[model samples]
Target: MEILIPLTASLVLLLIGYFIGTILEKKHYQSINDREEKFINLPSVTMTYRAASKETDMSKYSKTQLVSGGVVVSIDYFKRFLALLRNFFGGRVSSYETLVDRARREAILRMKEQSSGADMIINVRLETSTISSSAGDSETVDSIEAFAYGTALYK
Candidate 1:
């Protein structure tokens, strides 16, 4: 009876965490999609340093400046728990994929928002880093930081 009590308690907690995490993740993704759509027409973003040869027209822009955006995202308890189990299997950590994708997209949207006055953003770059947190005696990756930067040209 004693063993069953602890096991049941653990299972209940895990179930609660999973449901809450799923809801929060879906909500965040919905918000991201809405914001992305809002900024879809802001400016053209590209990783290439220069536009295609035929499209290059330096005379169109009168000013250029650097624009950047950064975001920090953390995984919920359910995702962290899933990741811990995946670590033992030595396979891709699928739980972290959505977290990383969200951070990256949010960063890019913020960069575009910051450069709303620009005609286009070129030479775009993205960077990501893991943030660690102390859990009792050990440190674990608790969140991720994403940064996006680019050069904005204004007409």
Candidate 2:
């Protein structure tokens, strides 16, 4: 009975911590999304258009390359390391995957929104980064940034 009481207390505390962390992290995610939306809606004026590939003579179709200005956004959420640690014992680190996916999608959607009159975008690339650490570690501060780019073409 005595051991059970302590174990129960530990479990309760763990649950409470998780709940609080989730709430805070959600709020942070919302904030990041808001900022990204604004960036996507911002106007982009094109001065010159160029293609990276020079296969003009080889290809039969005429292609106009549309390049979107790349923007890098730092991850705004806190307590991510704690969440990752907790994930090892729990099911999985859902939050990390969710955040990464969100950033990639938002970057692409925003680029499309900013660049108008493009038929298709090909060869999309995503780059990941953190504020302080290059890689995520147990005792390291958790921060993430995503860089997304693609070649937009007009047919």
Best by lDDT: 1
Show where candidate 1 strays beyond 4 Å: 1-9, 47-54, 134-136, 139-141
What digit string (tens of lDDT, one per residue) describes model 2 on residues 73-108?
A: 333233354465776799666656766666665566
Model 1: per-residue Cα lDDT over 1-155, one tens digit each: 78899888878877887898889889989989999898777665565655532477778789988999999999877788899999898799999999999999999988988997887888888999988866654647589999999898888
Clashes of 2: 0
TM-score to true structure, per model: 0.85, 0.48
Candidate 2 residue runs with Cα over 4 Å from true position: 1-63, 69-81, 87-91, 133-141
Kindly report which residue pairs in candidate 2 clash with one another.
none
- The per-model lDDT (C-alpha) reads 0.85, 0.56
Which 10 successive residues of model 2 have the least lDDT summed?
43-52
